[model samples]
Target: MMYISRRERFSAAHKLWNYEFSDEKNIEIYDKCANANFHGHNYELIVTLRGEIDKSTGYVFDLKKLSEILNQRVINKLDHKNLNLDVDFLKDLIPTAENIAFAIWNEIEAELKTANCQLHKIKLIETENNFVEYYGQMQS
Candidate 1:
């Protein structure tokens, strides 16, 4: 199978605080990320798809169509928004890079399947040194 990737960027704000945890406990675990005021990140997302190349087009999946799918399903929901409040799919989950990648995978997996593409991976970069990759695995 051939693999293709599309990358997109978005800016969003989130704070890693758990309502069930005490303020001190949250701060102890998340440090500055537990700030009530929140913080922002210029996030980069790379989505990879795997499929057999179509003989007529000589492509695994059309790059332009992949880009449009990424923009419509993920970027539009996240760009310049508050991850903790503005996004519907992320409402119940903590806005960590790992969770973000998983959420993004869920957001576009079905659409990709409909187009004869299989989602291979989701890589979310939260900062220069921080990133996460999700391969559609369920957590035990």
Candidate 2:
């Protein structure tokens, strides 16, 4: 099996705060990320596909088609939006990198399946030092 990856960029803002927690506790747990206002990240998203290369096409996935599915399903929905409020798919979830990566995989996995590909991984680069990798399914 082989893996093909596509990289896309987006900017978004979020604040990691739990309403049930006291402000001091939330700040202690999330630190600067729990700021009342918000902060933004120039996020880099990597979507990976795993499958055998098609014999006729010599490609695991058609880059053009894959790009369209990604843009329509993921980028358009996430770019420049407030993850805490504006994104329907992300409602009620903390907009942390881990959750965002998982959310992204959920948004695009079905389209990949239709195109004969499986979503192998989602790597979200929230900052140079902070990133998260998510596999669509839980491991045993």
lDDT of the candidates, in the order given: 0.91, 0.89
Question: Candidates' TM-scores?
Answer: 0.95, 0.94
RMSD of 1: 1.9
- Model 1, 1-140: lDDT tens digits are 78889889999999998889999999999999988999999999999999888878888888899899999999999999999999999989999998889999999998888355688999999999999998897659
RMSD of each: 1.9, 1.4
- The ten-residue window of minimal lDDT in model 2 covers 108-117
lDDT of 2 by residue, 50-125 (tens): 9988888999998788888888888898899988989988998999999999888888888788454688999999
lDDT at position 40, candidate 1: 98
